[model samples]
Target: MGTAERINSSQRTLPYVEIMDSTLRDGEQTNGVSFLPHEKLMVARMLLHDVNVDRIEVASARVSEGEKEAVRMICRYADQIGKLDRVEVLGFVDGHLSVDWITDCGGKVINLLAKGSLKHCTHQLQKTPENHIADIKETVEYATSKGLSVNLYLEDWSNGMKDSPEYVYQLMDELSSVSTIKRFMLPDTLGVMNPLQVIEYFRKMIKRYPDIHFDFHAHNDYDLAVSNSLAAVLSGAKGLHVTVNGLGERCGNAPMASVQAILKDQFHAKTGIVEDQLNGISRLVEGYSGIAVAPNQPIVGENVFTQVAGVHADGDTKDKLYYNELIPERFGRKREYALGKNSGKANIAKNLEELGLELTPEQTKRVTQRITELGDKKEIVTQEDLPYIVSDVLKHDAPEDKVKLISYVVSTAYGLKPGANIKVEINGQQYDGSAVGDGQYDAFVKALRYIYKKYLNRTFPILANYQVSIPPGGRTDALVQTVITWHYNDGLLRTRGLDADQTEAAIKATFKMLNIVESNL
Candidate 1:
């Protein structure tokens, strides 16, 4: 058929998009990432109840003791709500191990992995394709007799389509003709298939067995997981396999957010996914899995929606020329303008809008220059530092240098209390105090609090966060940076202090806080 004919045929099948999420199983298999039992249960509920995934493969049978418990807990919760059939487990060709595991765990569906390619059947299993098919057939028969559904997985089917199409075709033909197999999972085991190939091969399969349900599974070896998944959907594949945050073996699986977004926006395909909860769910998965998502990762990434270029921010002000169909707000996030070397006046204006600040052209230019200089020195500029950038660049005579720490001393001996002495001047009024704290910086903050509370009779700002960063090749005293967050009536403000000593870093941040607070007077 031609492209239009395919499109017409696809549109007719658009109402039947299927999404099977294996984040709990395949995603948890990410090396060095393990989800706790409760986390496993939580992610399972989110994938089914919140994201509305059609089915979730919670775990692989015979993995480990913890995995068994995790699967058991998830099964119990799923079975409690009458949605037990929506959960599945990965089972092997070893007949009873998987069957009994599923029966004991209260699982209803088993995705049985069997040889699809001739190479796997002959080389890996050391058996002929027909004999291998017999084994899978018997396994399915046994499971069916036990009142369980079987989904057959043709592992490495992508390569089978290329090198051994006949073997793949024969296997599909056999399984399709079998009543025990409920679904056929076609996996690009190595993530080697391109969009055109996915379209072509999927067409071949659907034409041969239009009645058989095929679920397309993709990997990200070439970073084409989402594209291939979309192609599968467009080519009339009934189900698509995905993982949360694209977490899986090798490069990962197609991220559920990307697939859902593309389907809903481009193809007008509808999924039961609650689009708004994408961020929260992604974060929960990340925290439990201990996988750090890169900042530029699409959809659920931290910086995906942030505009870092000045021109983009400028366009955003005019008509949103920089905007794309991937709006962050649609996925429970807000757009932000990054402050950096590339951030021009427009970027500055965007930050000012958030901080409720308006500066003249000259002031804006000065602030922008200082930010660029900081960027040149390889500094990360966060929105919290904008006010200080403005104050430093504008340099409106320094405002009397109201807060000055004339002298401070901290000593950490072999076995002695960590004490700090600080002498600070606020508006030419100086106060000196000494205090001991749990740590050196804590001692300093305690003394400062004494001066601010007893002497000034004012409420000190609340510290919301504390972050410290060293250069790439870390050194204990090599210009350590301490960023402190303080909240006042206006809002929260972040101030950073860098120095060779950690205590000095805290002192610098304290000075910035004093200035920020005194500026209002």
Candidate 2:
């Protein structure tokens, strides 16, 4: 039987691993990440209602008044929806201060942070094990009186397990008797534990306290957060702590998408997460956190589902031989075949199929070779570039000339704005325009736009992004490749040019864009 089937058949008996997302709380610990009160509320709603994560940690107690307001806003909305239990806030073991702060904000749950390592307990808090236990007990009792559910976070539990097992055991043994404690949360605070260590240590905790509920939280200091989280689950952890986009302090935490994928695909464990919403939430978090997700980042990254190699595309075309169980469709994404130097005829054919165009074998070979040549020059050959590339390689001249640059002059002076004068032939008529701008390229584009608007009585495409690069370790005079992306009515169009001067290269790319947009019109 499949893992899901096996787990489902024994549904009531199998352990259901609950996911607690801490993007707003721990994730905000990322350097330079601070969410406004309204942003925090919006994220909480999305995580709870849209993504359907089991729980969400929204903020820490007593951090700031802004944090208080954010927590209150999230709590108010959560209360209205009968999901108040699903929202949690991190608290400290500081008597009733954190508890009182949470209570004032209408929070129903508190994830109380306690020192797990012997060094932390002795040096950081300057308290004996007996005193620390007494403090935690007092806080739990006070929180329970306020009708708040409590979960304990054993901070630095991984290091504690390794360096001071007796103290960790003493702490757990003491806290396990508290009836108000809903879960005993263990965190690899320093991210020092590996998969094997996680399995062994987590299993030891489970065996010793078989009746206690455990939630495993991981850090990515060593890039093993996801692996350690999976190990925890396999060793009988009933809950996991996660952050969207893996945003956290230092190296961050295990990413939610990766953890979800591993749980479902590898372990057959079920979660409340809606797989399709993963990408949407990831993007949302990426924006709010100001952390750019790596293009190769698993599941939600831009290039994860894209095939860049021709052989891989050919294999996928045949029988999906290059496909993995982590299909892009599972996350509301599509598989894309990239066009570049490595793209063979099969890759060209795939792109052609998408564009609803077909070419003979000879045409295909020529187009592929041209694309390879462009790629060798470190220029990206996007699918939108295919028509121009085909026209260039096939030597199709007459129809391709919609707008052509006749002559242009650019000047720059110290402490003065750059200026440009451009002459262009559009539809076989010459138009001249001059403009001053922030830079030479900007000035050139401004002149082009002026000619299009005033002379031709037509609007031009908006320049969306412009990137320039030269081969690494090249001389100062090496060819500079400029790729310009333009937002047109149809879609985004990218055109590339190569020249010794950066401004000239950008101008060349812009000219290509004008002609392409003219042809489309």
Highest TM-score against the true fold, candidate: 1
Q: In angstroms, how far off is 95's CA in candidate 2?
A: 1.4
lDDT of 1 by residue, 1-521 (tens): 99788776766668767788999888876888888888899999887787777889988898888888888888888888778999999998896889888888888889999986899889999998888888899899989888889999999999999999999988877778888899999999989999999999999998988898889999999999999998988877888999989999989999988899988887778788888788878888888887877888778887898898999999999888999888887887778888888999999899988877889998888899898888877787877678766767776544455788889898777687799998888888889988999899988888899898999998888775576788445576588888887777756676788888877887898788778678766
* Model 2 regions lying over 4 Å from their true place: 1-14, 397-521
* Residue 91 lDDT, candidate 2, scale 0-100: 96
Q: Candidate 1, overall lDDT?
A: 0.86
State every prediction's TM-score relative to the real structure: 0.80, 0.79
The per-candidate count of clashes, in order, stands at: 0, 0
Candidate 2: worst-modelled 10 consecutive residues by lDDT = 6-15
RMSD of each: 5.6, 5.8
lDDT of each: 0.86, 0.89
